[model samples]
Target: MKMNTKGILFVYTMPLVLLHESYGFFVPGYPTKHISVSPQGKLLSTRSIPSTTTKPSLYSPSTSTSSLALKSSASSDDVQSITATNKLDSILSKLTSAFPFFVLGSAILGLMKPSSLQWTNQGTLISWMLASVMCATGLTLEKKDFTNVLAKDFAAVPAGVLCQFLIMPLTAWAIGRTFLLPLPDYGPSLFLGIALVGCSPGGTASNLVSLIAKADVALSVLLTSCSTILAAGVTPLLVKVLVGNAIHVSGWTLCEATARVILLPVLMGMIVNAKLPNLASKVSRFTPFASVVLVSLICGGVVSQNSSMFLSSKALLPLIVGSVMMLHCVGFAMGYFVPKVGLKFSEVTSRTISIETGMQNSALAVVLARSMGASPVASLPGALSATVHSCLGSILAGYWHSKNKKGKEESSESNKKDFTDRPEDDYPELLI
Candidate 1:
């Protein structure tokens, strides 16, 4: 229901903090040592050793974390500490690292407006960005990974895909019929909303989000890989079954469209990744920012064009809110449940499914909708999904983070209790 820029802002800003810390800047307790200059004010080549009698200087990680913490805690103009050089260096570092994402976002923004480029021209830009990202994904992969596609894990892939392609679509359809059908002319948009969820792939951020939530990282990756590989085929079929009539859909048409816009790019990336791993690696590094920029532009364009439909569609708000909530919940649940369905959802896999389901490829939805010449209303589902997913994912991940923290605390407390209650003489080995 909300556009969660918090993650994007963090993604854009964290590097700055890291850069500042790495550069011996304003960050406190960051191991900055003083160096004396010669009388001529030139830098001294030789460093003086401290007296042997001096105590060893303390360096604490807590102190390092706390020093950055201080910067965040300060009141306006209350500047309690920090060197001007360090501050400037820190600021500069942040700016430099964030520039690429900024520029990419700006370029996408400019391209989204019809005034910015011809219709034919836009395809090249989208293709370039997608191709670049795919290449990146390809570079990181090995033939060994695909082996899993044929192994026992293969069934899990379909199980997970079924959840995405089957469960999610059905849920959306039911919700639309029950809650959205009442609104006149909103029928197609509702179907469009369901299709948007049905057609999306696992989001790139799912692994990290799963980790943040303290879920299974490996399982998350596996499910994502399975679901994504199948998305190109499965997404369209699901859409056809759910909303074919409402949107004048044809299975072959959707399938071909999926192959071009989604499948081919992915396969090409895989091929490149297999053939030139180094090139794939280089491109992968930039894909995260590039993908974000692409999605942002696509969403912004949808919003801009459909501002009226978004406002007028009475079911718009509920549809957005309900769809996101349901999709996220279903993802998390299926990730958990399906693992238990004989695939053995490792602690990590459950976490992975939880994240993968929640973060769908909403950008693809927008691109697909726009490509189909669907109304801006049709694009609304994608835009709303994009806006809501990021925000909801963050909140969910934060919740999992908090739970993990609490679990650790409880375990610590239990350990302490046992230690305190034990007799040292009875179990002396425990003392070690």
Candidate 2:
């Protein structure tokens, strides 16, 4: 049921994603413009660049046919190569934008045929794949991004992280109890997996989602980076505190695993990005797409291995799905409302916080679940959480995008005398 419900969630979510992607991303209203300069040294918009209209003078000597032919062929080759590159990029963009659909399809396949992804269920394989995703995400960051968050003026960073760690752990526990997840003797409940997931850091995909939502992308990046770094210590402590009586969670073991699997690779990638930006830029383009693929595989592998759990009980699936989805929904609501209404943050920053808080690093949760020696079915919640939050995030982005647009329109109506038509001193605030 967890797998099937996730499939349904993705199926419903794809059209929303596609609708936004048509406007250039899993979002709308943010279009990029390309401009070029002519040989005569005039800047021109690509859409309106005029062709040469000057006629040749009668006295001019004729150029050689062979030289002219070679030049023409060379130019034609360059144009063809450029065209092919653009097409590849467009296709890749579409694939990444429609990522939830692909993950859903993979989940369906793995659930139907468990043996196909059975080989990928090993502990080492999960660890390596998760590490690679973390590394890929880190490659897109630089020293300045982390440093900016540490600046004294960035008060929201610490506050947001505090809320994430505090709110999510409690939320997960409450939701589990509400759903009546068994208390140990009933044969290895999902408490361990839910606890670990609740304790997870912000996902790497938060920044992308924030971008699509027109939120504060920089703030989201900082929150993800800070929470991930702190997870090495905080997650282990929280897990020990939450479900220590039922599950023997070794703080040292969990901490070591996190540092090795998550922190070290992230730092390594950051170093490379900082020291060798040229190489990082070229590699970063493909990292987002690769991370999406790795996430699908991890989710599929978990579902495939636990197919028996799904097959055994049709009734328990909804409980698991509802709990996981509710966890993220609570996280999003509290994360946003606390900052926006309670603390009086700007709309963009609040939206960013909400996304970063809600989108848990479920892949990390899946790895930790297996590493902790919980039941095979324990990883089910983490596997399905990814799909649930992605669907919710898309809906939020669309709603917020339309909201910001309407606000701008209303403001425009109010300020009919925009900039140039008004006195310079009277319109200073509207210049931008």
lDDT winner: 2
Off by over 4 Å in 2: 1-25, 29-86, 148-153, 183-188, 407-432
Cα lDDT of model 2 by residue, 65-153, tens digit: 11121122247776666555545554455556555665665576567767767878864898899999888867877777767766733
- The 10-residue segment of model 2 with minimum total lDDT is 57-66
- Pairs that collide in candidate 2 are none
Model 2: lDDT equals 0.72
What Cα-based lDDT does every candidate model obtain? 0.54, 0.72
Per-model TM values vs. the true structure: 0.63, 0.80
Error of 2 at 205 (Å): 1.6
- Model 1, backbone clash pairs (residues 3+ apart or across chains), number: 3
> lDDT per residue, candidate 1, 286-358, as tens digits?
4544555555555555555554454566556666667666766676676567656656755555555556766
